[model samples]
Target: MTPARFAGVLSAAVTLGVAAACSDGGSPVDPGGCAADLTTGIAAYDLDGLDVHAVLPTSTSSCIVANADSHFVAVDPSAQPSGRLFVFLPGSAARARNYRKIAFAAARAGYPAIVLTYVNDLPVGVRCAFGTGDCYEEVRREIITGVDASSRLTVGPDDAIEGRLVHLLTAMESLDPGSGWSTFHDGASPRWDRISVAGHSQGGGHSLFLSRETTVFRATAYSSAGDLEPLSATPVPWLDGSWATPAERIGGFISEDDEVVSPSGAIAAWTRIGLDDFGGPVSVDDTAAPWAGARMLTTRAPPRNAGAVFTPHHGVTVVDGLTPLELDGAPTFGPVWAALSFPGS
Candidate 1:
């Protein structure tokens, strides 16, 4: 699809909003004091050197769907960017707005970041009856199906999601020269060579697919298991051991007590990719030769959210306002942040 058409579909599907809480004149460090006041028990990180900007759809597109509001650009205004792009994909039934804190933290740590939203197929107001019933399973199937559809539409030549994303990146690059999104590339195309992708839940599964299609320096999936082959073909590297890139660059984060995607799936993915189980919070197997970059992390403890007490451990990675219990000196979100900021860490 043409960029214009893709933008129209996205704009028609979702509304956009500036993240006022992160912007406005305030201390660049923790702009709205969001990081400092996180009740999720994850340690607060500083965003002192960065500026968060709301993106608007480019003027040419009739639909105002895929702009900075629905997406965000986090950059440091003080210095030249390293030309690296860190893209974060939100989970099923979740929007990019929910991950602003993580994006901001990435930018603070010096990685230009973008938070993306895809189709959410989960029915509204339906809660996963974790362990009590099969409601969660039904919802999960729908979510996986939705993810497959969205991926097929976006990643390939049809370009529903991927096209709109490139269009927005191009626009943002032009809107702010020498800073923000612009620092990553000229208006023509992104510095694809320096890109890394990360996602949570359904988005995590999508990230795995995207890494297979596009060569990224690093890819990380959180609270997600690989989809069934019939639903979405497993990435070639994961199955045939013929990685498109080094296996060391791919990682997975699984919450030990996750009630959403099976923890076994995450473990399986890690083991399939040649990582060994160290029986610890984090595991690494740099000696795996071709797959030297593979790593896996299990959440030190179960996750909790103030809003939903019963639904524990499902979305500990990207649930907005949810803090993770620190394990091995890092919170649930820590592994993801590290993957984006310091690839191979």
Candidate 2:
């Protein structure tokens, strides 16, 4: 169920309820249903007073955080928060800073957002040289062993990623008590029930995994990668004839021209999860068009730095110049911001 389809279904449900009420001779139902308008322009939320902070992890137990190799970018609202927390994870070899645009958009909408960078055990040069298959396995092993051996927290035996994430969330909760971290962590009578998580490439895969691992996150948006093995292994239903997450809670974006992660794989994953076809790909030249209603925005390779080895298509989701319609032409947010901000609206 794509977000568009989910919206349609929700609208239908509301209509049916209204009809039932009318038939019962009750008061007329209010015409206004859900507050979100999928086709409407992105909201022009104010970003003034939003503070951006860089935090270096001091916990030696978290190998990914305390190793001096990993850090995070946090965007917090100046006033009391709305209790909405958005977590962004970067792709392999990419740092948190790359996704600052998305975080800035989330902050503008009154949600405190964090862009988290994991240990880049495999640098870009090494990854490009060895290829994704070998480097992926090596990075996976490093995360597993690193967290199991060094982490003080324990989500589960096979949940090293979740464990490290827990540590980070704990640290962030302490950093800003008013930022709603306590609501996320307090098991008993937690002030908040769930959060929003988004990522790109490898980070996207991690976001998907976290969705299944914890019910703490109410929504997830991811791009560039759709390795469904982890989701399949978990009890969460996705394309395997089991119940799946509500479409409104799961948002995805992928470039048809992406050379790194196959667009077909992403489509297959989306199909299995039951998303309606939003539309054909947006041309690279159509970067200025509004992307509020687009589920998949086809784009050409983004311009790369001189002598850069990797292709630009792979980095489309994190490009700094892109913006969602909600930002009203603010070029600071990427296309993925639509999905990240969708559930909040």
Candidate 3:
């Protein structure tokens, strides 16, 4: 979905920060039952996922302290009557905004997406001067710190943090019209038959860890690099310390030329993603030289008439910038959407 198309639906009062699917030639499936004005141009209700909610971590640990303002947004957007869940943990505030486009686009396509807005809750004076290269390191440190209790930075993990992350998908399964108004829902009750977690930059690292650590998540989609040399100080393994099984459902989107996450680590990870039947090679390789030993899902440049589609731009703009509508036609989501369309891939 493009931003313009998304803005068109602003007539309805769905909540912010988090935001899919359907068959052909049918009336759009909006759980909210929006007015015709709001649903117009929706183009067959290609999507229908919920905004769910957000979570704020309260830990005082160095990682959490450095990232006290960060939050997580959880979503569920599988094809079943009872859908699957996906969590988006963007490393930066800008990255979070970028996912909003993806979330809305997915929602338009009928998949529920959650755009985490934890940055909005950050302390006013906080600032990181590092460029993209160091940014990843800084973000990684913060994430590790956030999860580690022994770190010098110390704070309490708000009890709600875990629940909020889990509830987005849980709520999707037991969705009732009245549920939308509730601020609290018990995620533990939901049957998470299939869960895929994804993120960008630092978020991607977290997604990798979450997918590996959580038995409930069936697959994961991480963007950028192969893998970082394991953190020097931390005992927690990168990806999952316990050596979680190769993700039966692991895939990532790598820009042939992404500077933020060097394609190398991402390619290396594909070696693992390919071990299982559905695990291998769902990667959308943008470079001419595909990752060795990995199946590549290559994309041709957008048709001349269609203007340029798909570029190195980060987040949802990777999709939204291509379309005519403010949000209806984002192409950034094409790859992720395509992956989701396939079952057990």
Candidate lDDT scores, in order, read 0.49, 0.47, 0.37
The total number of steric clashes, by the backbone 3 Å criterion, in model 1 comes to: 5
lDDT tens digits, residue span 1-345, model 2: 246534553453333222111111121112121121212211112235555545443231222223333444355555345567777767767777677777776776667776765554443223334243333333443343233322222222112343344444554443433465655544212222356777777667555544443443444434544353332222113233432345435556666667666776666665554544554344434665455454444544443441354555566556443322234645433434644442445
Backbone collisions counted per model? 5, 5, 51
Candidates' TM-scores?
A: 0.62, 0.61, 0.51
In model 1, pairs of residues that clash are 11-65, 40-323, 55-68, 248-293, 248-294
How far is 47's C-alpha from truth in model 2 (Å)? 11
**Per-residue alpha-carbon lDDT of candidate 3 for residues 56-113, written as tens digits (9 for 90 to 100):** 3321111122233433332333433224444455544433444555555444443345
Q: How would you order the candidates by lDDT, starting with the best?
A: 1, 2, 3
* Better structure of 2 and 3 per TM-score: 2
C-alpha RMSD of each candidate structure in angstroms: 12.8, 16.7, 12.3
Worst 10 residues of 3 by lDDT: 35-44
- Alpha carbon lDDT at 322, candidate 3: 30
